[model samples]
Each structure stands twice: as C-alpha cells, then as structure tokens.
Target chain A: MSTVLLDGTEQLINGLMYGCFYALIGGGFTLLFGVLRRFNLAYGSTIMAGAYAGLIPVYLFNAPVLVLFVTTIVVSVLVGLLVEFCCFRFLRKGHELAPLMTTIGMLIVIDETIVYLTDAVGLKYPAPFGDESLALGPFLIRPDYLAILVVSVVSFSAIFYLLYRTRFGRAMRAVAERPDAAQILGVSVRHVNVLTFVLTSALAGIIGFFAAVSVGSARPEMAAWLTGKGLVVMVLGGLGSFPGAIVGGLALGVLEFEAVWFLGSSYRDILAFAILFLVLIVRPGGLLGTRTA
Target chain B: MEYYVAIGSIIGIHAMLGLSVYLVAISGQMSFGQQGFFALGAYLAGLSTALWGLHLLPALVLGVVVAAAVGLLVGFPALRVRGLYLAIATFGFGEIVRLAFLNVRYTRRIGDRVVGPNASEGFRHVRYIYDRGITPLEYLGIILLALVVVVILFYFLERSKLGAKLRAVEEDEVAASMIGINVTRVKVFGFTVAAGVAGLAGGLFIHYSSYIDHDMVALPLAIASVTYPIFGGLGSFVGPLLGAVALVGLTESLRTLHGAREFIYGALIILTMLFRPRGIVDEALVLRVKGWLPLRAARRPAPAP
Candidate 1:
C-alpha cells in the first residue's frame, strides 16, 4: 500500500509537469482562435519553428539560455505575422473554408522547409535547467520538469491578466464578440487580429523552448505531434474558451500520465485519444464552455 | 514496364482519395480525417489477407465494411456538432484511430514468447489482382471503370431527393427543419455516405499498393485531400478530378526539386485565396489580346439603338 501510494504521488507529479506543455500549447491555440475566428493548421509548425529558432542561437553563438528563449519568441511572432499577411489577411472576410485551406497549405510548406533544413534529422539541444534532480521522499523530480511547470504557470497567469485586466484585452474581447460592432465603435479589427496572432505565436515559441528542454531534442515532426494533440486539447477544452483550455490541458495531462503509468508508454497515446473521442462524443462544447452562439 | 503500371495504380489511388473529399465538401462539410479511414482500410485489408489467410477480394470488402462501421460510429456525434467544433472532433477521432493503431498490442505481430492461438504472429504472403503480369494499360482500364462507376453513383445520388435534402440542410438547417426535412437524418446520412466513399478508396489503395503502415494515413495527406476539391473549384463534379490531376502532376514533376513542390502548393493556395477566390474555372474571366496593328484596323463609331 505504501509502494502504491508512492507510485501514485510520482505519477501525479509527472502529470502536472506534462500538463504544463499542454496548457501552453492549448492557450496559444485558443488565443488565436478567439480573435481570428479561424483555425490555423500551421500552428504546430510555428512551434517547431520556435524550437529551431531557439536552438540555432544557442548552438551557433553559444548564447545564454535567456537569449535563446527571447530569440525564439521573437521569431515565432514574425512567423505569425508572415502567415497572417501571406495566407490569412486577404481571406479574412471570404468564405470560411478559404483560410482553413490556406493554413493547411502553409503547414505543408513549413514542414517541408524544416525537413529540408534539418535533413529530417532530430537535433539535440542543451536542457535549460541542466541535469540536476531533486528528490521528495521516494520520488525523484528533475529540475527541468519543475522549471517547465513554473514557466507554464507564469505564462498562463500573464495571459489571464492580459486578457482580463488590460485595455487591449477589452478591445480584443469586443472584436471577438462582434467584429462589425467593434469596428463601428472605433476598434481596428485588423490590428487586433494581427496582434492576437503575434501574441499566440509568441506563446507557442515559449512552449517550444520548454518542450526542447523537456525532450532535449528538436525535430520537424515535433510540430506534427503537438498540432494533433493541441487540436484535441483545444476541442476538449472548448473552441474559444480561455479558461476551458486550462482545465482541459490539466485533465488531459493527468489522465495521459496515469494511463502511461498503468498501461505502458506505447499505449499512452491510445488512451489519451480515447478520452478525447469520448469527450467529443459526450460534450462537444467542452466543460465550462458557453452555449451561446 | 512494371514501373509505369505501378505509377498508374498510385494515381488511381489518389484519384479515389480526391473523390472522397469532393463528395464530403460538396455537402458543405469539411473533413480532414479521410486519411484515417484510408489507413484503416489498408491495414485491415493487409492484415486479413496476409495473416488471416483470407482471399484478397473478401479481405478488401471486409476492410471497407469495417471502415464504414467506424465512420458511422463517429458520424453520429459529428452530425450534431457544427463549425470548428465538428472539425476538431473529426480531427481528434483521426488521431485516436492513429494512436490506437500504433499502441494496440493486437496490432503488433512479431517476436512474442506467448504461446497459443492468441499469440502474436507476423503476416506472410498476400496477393493482388495486378500481380498477374498486368500491363499499365490494363490497370488504367480498371481505374477508368471504377472512376466511371463512382461518377455515375454520385451523379444519381446528388440528383436524388435525399441529396437535395442534404443540400438544403447544408444551406440552412433551421429552414430545412421548418420545411419538414429531417436535418439530423440528412446530416448523418451525408456523413455516412462520405465515409463509405472514403472506405472504398482506402480498400482500393491497399489492393493497389499491397503494403501498408501507420505513416500512410496521416494529417498531411488528409489536408491534401481537402485542398484538392477546393482548389479545383468545388462547383461541380469535375472540379476535384481536375484539381487532383493538376496537384498530383505538379508534385510529381517537381519531385526532384527538393522542397520546391510543397512551397508551390502553399503559394498556389495563397494566390488562389487572394486573386481567384472562386477558383480557376471562373466563367466571366478570360484573357485576350486585341489586334496589335492599328494601321489597317477599321474604327467603328457607337451606334444609337
């Protein structure tokens, strides 16, 4: 019984750490979706771009870890703007499928570019928090895991404060609730949309930085896995609900970790997807999602 | 050569994929998960033929049936969901299917010490119809026959009462409901039909390739299928076919150019959205050059009607 309790506690800690990545990815997805009203299929690719961006600076210049994080975030912001200007901006008011198709195309383009640059080989990166481990009773926790959790919490709080307390957040909410009305009321919907993309992409970059630390490797295919999982998390949380993303991410993380613990690592993803499918079938709007509109 | 025959069959497989997307999109619902069904069909067919010792035709049929069943199960909930939520649900379903294939112990059939009937046993020999020294022209003939059958079936269905009802529901669910059309039923049926078509394509693809794996069924392929129909115009039956030919042809031609092909696809999609939002088949648009020589040209004055 004591052994089981120890195992459970360890699993719980692991789940919390894993949930941090999901939360960051989900938050970025929800933010963009809220303001753009369009799903960006290339979102995962942006995260990969961020990871590579962070790595190149670290490897080439022997830069500080902080600089790597900042560089990645900035590059992701630029990429987001590039996607918006190149693929989305012109089709903002067009048919719904237009932008979706454009983004799908963008995903392929970005993925192929990454593959070309890296020769489809996975690149290893130095872990930001070093290889130090801390033990709590029988459970051993890595410093990187703790750092990831801290970063996720800080990022989520920052986003929440920005969304609720800032004037720009109010304008964004206004645009999301009613674009034409917001425009009539002197809000620049275009500016709001662009800013939202930049912010969301930057968040994805930060998440990428942490993900590289956790996995100790960066690859083109990293984005593909996250994109699929992130989409699931976004849907399971509710499409446009900010708080729902947090709840959904945490739930998914915990559940997936427990599954991995019991069912072996191979079956972990299977269990996660089963839960996703069940959630979609049972509660399409996700927990805490408003039914209005 | 045998290589030409192989290429032709692959094209046929892609054509089937494009048609599945076309059928779904025409009803105003977008699915980015057809590749999941395609993978399911291929894997099931391959396993049945190679491991279960089933005949190729029977295995193909069973594979398609299984795909349709899975599609119906997913479609029930999907029919009720709308917009981005529906898209996400389908996307999630696809991921679940992929992960299930990856993780399920029953799927792996090699190097297990367990004894008895339930023990993991690897696949062995499997045969396809095209293995009998069939020529490229014969394969093309078979493909054309299948294409004709699919076209006729879709044409009749799209012109039928059920198809009209589905279209009505797509246009306006509230209005469709008010007119006594069962919107839910139409949506479910539409989704099921789309799935069935995709299942058939998947089965055909497996038979054509005679080999299958998880990577074959992925999101990029799904996205490609979706893009084909839209890029071709999506206004008529021929649109997706045309789009598939252009896209596949372009990709193949640029296969040796490193990453340029994908870049072109991305650029094409962006350009299409910006300039020809309606697609290349715009009836009102045409390019013409007037006679360059002004010397011997007769100038006509405007006449009052």
Candidate 2:
C-alpha cells in the first residue's frame, strides 16, 4: 500500500476509536433527552466531575490507577442525582425554557465548583496501556484505543441489556414512553428519573476516564466542547435513540478527524458543526431518527 | 474620564448585543448565534476599512446587512426547530462561523505597512475612524446615539401591531398561525433583525478597541446574551437593557475578586433563577414604576390584580 493509503486507513481507525468513546458519552446525553425530554447541559459538568472525583483518591489517599474508575463512577452518579434534585426537579412545572436556563446556570455553578476545588488546570490521566500496540500488515493500532473501543462496545451492549432485558429497563422505558401512564401502572416517575439518570451518568464516568486518558489530560474547560460534541452526536444520531447515537457518533468521529487531517486542524470543529447545522436543516430528526410527522 | 467613557461604551455595546437576543426572545425562539453575527459584522467592518477604505457608517451598515442576510439563511431552517434543538442548532452555526473566521487569513495595509491577520491573531488597525483621531468621548457619543435609536425602535416595536404579532407567536405559535399571522415569516424576520443589531454591535466593539478577533464571540458570549433578557425580564423593551446594565455592572464591580468573579457570577444566576425566574423587571413592576413617574399615559388607572 502507498503511504497515502496507509495514512487514510490509520485515520479511519482513529476515527472509529473516537467514535466508540463519543457513542459512550452520547448515550448519556440521549438518555436525559429521552427520559426527561430536556438537554441536560450539566452532562458536561458530570464528565468533569468524574475526572475530579478521581483527583481525591489519587491525591489524598495516594491510590493507584485502579481507584480512578471507581471514583469516577461513584462521583458521576452523585452529581447526576444532585443535578436531578437541584436543577431538574424544581423546574418540571415551569415554562419550556425554564429548564434550559436553569440547567445553564447549573452548568456554570458546577464548572465553577470544579474550578474552585481543583485549580481547574490540566492534569495528566494515568494511562494503563503503557504504550502498547498491535501491529498489523500495514497499520499499527494502539491497544489503548482498542481497549477503549472494547470497553465502549461492552458498555453500550450492557446498556442495551439493561434497557431491554431487565425489569428496571422496562420501568425506565415505561417512564420515557408514558410517564403519567407509567405512574398509573405503579411505576414511580421520580424513582425512574433518578435511577435512569444514575445509569446514564455512570456511563459518562467511563467515557470521562477514557477521554481524559486518551487526550492525555483532563481540564474543566473541556466541558463545553464535550457537551457540544455530545450534542452533535446525539442530534446527528437521532435524539432519544441509543443505537442511532452510536452510528452517528462513529460517523461524526471520522468526519471530525478527517476534517483535521485533510483540512487544517482548526477546521475540524467547523466541519462538525457545519454538518450539524445542515443536519438540523435537512433532517431535524437526524440520520437514524424516525420521522416525527 | 477615559476609563469611565470606555467602560460605558462597552456597556452600551453589550446592551446592543443583549437587545439582539431580546428581539428573538419576543418572537418566542431561543437562538444562540448572535455572537456569530457579531463576529461577522466585526470582521466586515474591520476588513472594509483595512482593505477598501470604506468609512465607518457605510462599513457598519454593510456589516449589519450582511449579518442579517446570513441570519436569514441560517434562520430559514432553524426557525422550524424549537426550544433546546434550536438553541443547539444556533450554537452549531455559531461555532461554524467562529471557526471559519479563525481559519480565514486576511492581508491588509496599515499606514503604508502590510500586515496579515493570522489564524487567531484577528485584524488590527480596525478603527480607521479612530486613527483619524476620533476621541473616545466622540466614539462613545456615536455608540450612545445608535443605542438610543435602537432602544426607541424597540419601544415603538413594543406598541406596534407587528410587535404584538411577534408576541403572539411567542405566546403560542399555533394560535398565531390560526389567526392568519405568518409565523414563519415573523420568526425569520425577527431573527434577521436581531442578527443585524448584533452585527451592528460587533462593528461598534471592534472599532472601539481598534481590533477584531474570533475568540471574542464564542459560546460564553452567546450564553451571556441569553442571560440578559432572562435576568432582566422578557416582557418589556427595557428588559435586555436593564439586564445588560446590571450584569455588566456586577461583572465590573466584581473585578477585584479576580478568579472568584466567575464563580460569584454563576452563583448570582443560580440565585436569580431560584428567586426570580420572572426576572428582575416584569410587566407589573414596569407598570408601577411608570405609575410613579406621573406621565399622562402612565397615569391610567391600575388594572385589578
């Protein structure tokens, strides 16, 4: 194979790797949009919160890298519940725009809190892969990325299982499909909302760990961009559809990576957003979204 | 004082941006792309002066027109989306515009010397009018004049039939359309005008500082624009103006706290949402204040609560 072909193949694999992570993150965003029917802007903060949660065990307890995953999940779930109670529950009866404004406020507060707690500076994530890679005939794939891909795929499958095979999944879907009807059927809407948020946020924790590790550092400022990427993935896939999020995320990941590779690196975000803007224009429902009307 | 004059001008410029958001607020849409329009206007004004030697007024007007044109294009499809989806779509447009500018390279002449605008460096020597020795006070006067005109326009718009139609759409889109008001037309028009005003503000901002850059119009700026109308009260012409003044003042006053400033600012927003979701100034409050002023129109009997 020529050098260009090899580079192209490498870029495709890199994009796919990123797509796996984006899918994991986008699932959490879609879950909130699905169950609550609002953009939980705090989702970004939760990702950051996951990173900072690891800060405690690593710094205070001098814990090994193994502690990071547990801390991330635990903290994300707590933050998820906190957001549910403080930002979401109160505004349920308010105007349509109320939740948006309030959530934005919540995002700022959470961001600031992280900033205050940590210096809000970048910290290196402890990668466990140790620079290992498996070389194929023409391409070398990093085990780190493959690990993340495996983890993402497994997590997504687990989510599907939880959503499809479990009793909790039925109750969660029941709430999403018909909240009042679900309530009449003896499912507590509040419990379902909180529980579903916890599940989704736990996924965010895993995404957070992998993202910071892959990118080499975690910074509080990454929240907005992460949120935007998640939104791009969520909308591009079709809102409220996990399967669609995975497909859209993979496509978006490749599109963004190739945009930087072919065009200048700065053009990556522009291309992603341009596609998102076009998607909103051409098919508001997204690639895999069912036509509403 | 030059310092006070500069601060006041910044407040005025921000007020114009706030009003841009306000226009869309009344039309019942949540748009977060005014910063993109502002950047567009700033670049246009900056480029016209640097490259083509256009005067201030024409450049500003041109910027406004172009921004409005882009707004129409972006809003044509975006107006079909509502609430959160619309906000995200506008945000996507905003990021696209900002990134496009960041990637665009500009070469220009500055007093017999050639300079290039880099990826993030933006354009300098923007205020050719200022280079001709327009004093800060004079520039502030120009901005104040423009603001007064915009405010007066908003005031009249509040009382106008079309304004009522826009408000009607905000209150309920289906009902407005059922009553024969063209909802799509109204929304697109409001978005276009709003973007034009933001572009006008962008022109003012770059010229005032003699610089233009892409970073100045990012996501945070868009969020700030949204905050203005919501914090001040969305019901009246004064809402965005008041919100802008108060928030800008708060921000400036908290400058002493340094890093804590953003935290405090965020806290204030959360507190405001908690305590005053209706905002600091609503219809009743405006009415009461007007009642105390003793103007003829203000002297009308209070309606029964």
Candidate 3:
C-alpha cells in the first residue's frame, strides 16, 4: 500500500473513533431535548463530572477499568437527576426559556464546583488499554481508540433497539410524539421524562470516561470545548432525530479532521462553523429532520 | 484625573452594553451573541484609529458599519431560525469569530500598520472638540446625556408602529404573518438594530480602553448580556438597564472577594430565576407597591378617626 493511502486510512479511522464519541454525546443531547423539549446547557458539564467521577475510583484505589466506567455512569445518572430536580422539574411546564436559562446557570455552578473540587488543578487519567498500538493492514490504531469506537457503536445500537423494539421504547416514542396521547395510553409521562434524563446523562458520562481515557487527562475545563461541538452536532443532525445525530456526528468528525489536515488545524473550527452555517441555510430542518414543521 | 476618567468611561461603556441587550430583548430575541458584535465593532474601531490613523469619529462610524455588515450576514440565516436553534447558531457564529481572530495570521501580525485613507503620519496630533480640554466627569456626563437621548428615542420607537410590528412578530410569528406583517423582514431588522447597538457599544469601549482582544467578545460577556435582560424583567423597556446596573454593581462589589465571586454570580442567576422569574420591574408588582404605599399612609389618619 502507498504511504499516502496508509495515512488517509489512519486519519479516517481516527475520525471515526472521534465521531463515535460525538455520536454518544449527540445522542444524549437529542434524547433529552426530545423528551423535555429544552436544551440542557449543563449536559456538557455532566460529561465533565462523569470524567472526574471515573477518575476518582481509578486514581484513589487504582480500580480496574470496568469499575471506573461503572462509577462514571452511576455518578452521571445522579448528576442528571440532580439537574432535572433543581432546574427542570419545577419549571417543566413554564416557558421553554425558563429551564434553558436555569440550565445555563447550572453550567456555571457545575464548572465552579469542579474547579473548587480539583483545587484548580488539571488531573490526568490512565487509559486501561495502556499505551499499545495495533496494526490493521496499512492502518495503525490505538487499542483504546478502537475500544471507544466499538463501545459507542454497540451502546448507540442498543439504545436504538430499545427505543424501537421494547415496550418502554414504544412508550417513549409515544411520549415524544404526543405527551397527552402517551398519558392517555397509561404512560407515566413524568416518570418517563426523568428516566430519559437519567439515561441521557449516563450515556454522556460513559462517553466522558472513554474520552478522558482517550485524551489521557482530565481537567476542570475539559467539557467547555465539547459543549459547543456537541450542541452543533445535535442541531446539524436534526434536533430529535436519532439517526440524524449519528450521521451528523460522523460527518462533522470526518470533515473537521479533513479540514485540519488540509487547511491547517487553526482553521478547523472556522471550516466546521462555515459548514454548519451553510447546512442551516440550505437545510434548516437538518439533513434528516422532518420537513413538515 | 485619569483614574476618574477611566471610571466614567467604564460606566458609559457598560451602559451602552446594557442598552444593546435591551434593544434585542425588547424585540423578543434573546441574543447572547452581542459580545461577538461588540468585539467586532471594537476591533474595527481600534484598527481603523490606531492602525489606519483615521479620525476618532470616522473610526467609530466605520466600526459600527463593519459590525452591522457582519451582523447582516449572520442574521440572514438567523432570521430563519428561532428559540434554541437561533441561540445555538448565533453561539456558533460567536465562537467562530473568536477562533478566527485568535488564529488568523494577519489580525495577529498586522500590529498597528496604518492602512486606508487616514494613514497620514501627523493624524495622531489632530483632536476633536469632545476630546479637547474635557474633564473626565464632564465627558461622562456628556456621554450619559447622549445615552438618555438615545434611550428616549428608542422608547418612542418601541411604542411606534415598527416597534409594535417587531413585538407582534416576537409574540406570535404566525399571528404576525396572518396580519400581513413581514415576519422575516421584521426579525432581520430587529437583529440588525441590536447588532448596530452592540457595535456602537464596542466602538466606544475600544476608544475608552484603547485596547482590543478576542477575549472581549467571548461567551462570558454574551452570557452576562443575556442575564441582564432576564434579571431586570424582560416585560418592561427599562429592565435591561436596571438589570445591567445591578449586575455590574454586584459584580464589581464581588470582585474584591476573589474565587467566591463566580459562585456568587451563578447563585444570583439561579435565585433571580427562582424567586423573581418575571424580573424586578413587573407591571403588577409596580402597581401593587404603589397601592400599598398610599394605603399605608392613609391608614394612619383613618385609625385616629
């Protein structure tokens, strides 16, 4: 194989791995928005919290990778519930902006809390997969990156199947489509909403754990960068569309990396935003969003 | 004297920032991207004056023009979206602008190179009447006076047909469209006007500080602007102004407290949302306060009888 082909293949694989991470975040974002119809600005912070939560078990007791991951997910679920209780539950039926603004307020609180907890220090987390690179034909991928990709795909697929095939999944879709109708059909709307929030936060937390493992470090400000990208990916994929988010996340990941390679890394964000702007202009409903609205 | 001047200048600039947020929130668009426009305006003004050696007035005007032009470009897509989508799009735009400023070679490397028609070497010596022998207090007073005039004008505009149309569009786009109002055009106009105000504030900020950086136009400032309208009560015309003054004063007071300031700031936002969701200047509260105050005074005499 040619050297250029090998590099391209490697870049593509890397992009896919990163794309999987984004998909997880984007999926969580979409799920929350679908259920509540409110943007949770604190979602990114939850991810960060999850990373720190996972780091605690790993760093303090030198826990195995699986234990760290479980801890992260559990912590994220609690954080999500806390946010919903504090910011959303009371204001659920109020103006849409009420919960939205409250979430933004929560974001600042969470960020400050993290900063205070960490003593304003940046902490590093060791990857369970260790520092090993695996060779696949002409392409070389880190074991951890491959693991993240596989885990994300499986998790997302599981979510899709649950949402579509299970009785609970049917109820969720019913609630998403029409709350009144769902309630009439014996669905506990509030319970479902809370469950959705927990589910989304847990997913974000798992992603955050893997993300910290991938980056090999955790910091107070780790989630700030992810906030905008996750939001953009959610929007570009069509707000509540599960498939749309997956496609959008992958496309964005590939495009961003490609832009970095070709136009210099500095211009990567500009290119990403330009693409987002154009997509918004050309297709306001997103690539797979329902055009009926 | 310089210290006094700096204090006055900061207040004036902050008031301008407050008013910029006011203009957008009044029209029913909660734009947290004003900082982006503000930064653009400041950068344009600073570049034209310091680098291109333009006269201060022309530099200010040019800055406003540049900021408005960029606003128009961004606003076109914004007009098609609203709610969280619009907020997210504008947020993305603001981030892009910040990144571009940080990464763009020319913006960083240009380093006060005089460009355009005002590149004459002796231009720095020229002074406007406003700058000539003006005391800091007097300068501040004059800026406040000018702001008052602008506010009055905006007040009237809010009560005028265009303002009504803008409000109607905001309240219910479908109803506004049914009534034959151009929803898109009105929204774009509201966005442009808001952008222009932000630009004006930015230009003034640069002149006041004599410095410009990408940090000036980031998300924190945007969040501050958004919080102002919410805190002041979005229903009233004076809400943003009051909110801004209160928030700015509180922030200034908290600054001396060090690390706790941020936590306090976050708490303030949450508490305001929880307790006074309609803001401090709700019409019903004003009326109730008025009625209660007069009754209390009258009750003392009645009790004696």
Write candidate 1's Cα lDDT for B1-305 as tens digits. 67556666666667667777766665667777788787677667766765566776687678778878888888887757777777666766776666666544443344453211121222222345444665457756766676677778778886799878867776788998999998777777777766766776776665565544556677767877877777876655566777777887777777888778788877887788677664554223311112344532455455779
Considering only chain B, report the TM-score of each candidate against the true chain B. 0.80, 0.93, 0.79
| Candidate 2 C-alpha lDDT tens digits along B26-66 | 88888888999999998888777767888889989999999
Q: Report per-candidate TM-score of chain A alone.
A: 0.96, 0.95, 0.95
Share of the reference A-B contacts seen in candidate 3: 0.34
Which docking class does model 3 fall in?
acceptable
Backbone clash pairs for candidate 2 read none
Q: For candidate 1, lDDT tens digit of each residue in A1-293?
A: 58777777788888888887797788888888888788888898888888888878888889998898898899888888888887788773747777887877788778888888888998987876778789877788888888878888888898889889999999999998888999999999999998898889889888888877788898777888888778777877888888888888888888888887877887777677777767766787777677532
Please state every model's RMSD to the true fold in angstroms. Answer: 6.2, 2.8, 5.6
- lDDT for A126 in candidate 3 is 78
Question: How far is B148's C-alpha from truth in model 3 (Å)?
Answer: 3.3
- Model 3, B92-183: lDDT tens digits are 77777776666543332233543221221211211232345655566566557646865786788776998889778767889989999988
* Root mean square deviation (Cα) for candidate 2: 2.8
TM-score of 1: 0.90
Which segments of model 2 are wrong by more than 4 Å? A1-6, A116-120, A291-293, B111-116, B283-305
Per-residue lDDT, model 2, residue A165, is: 100
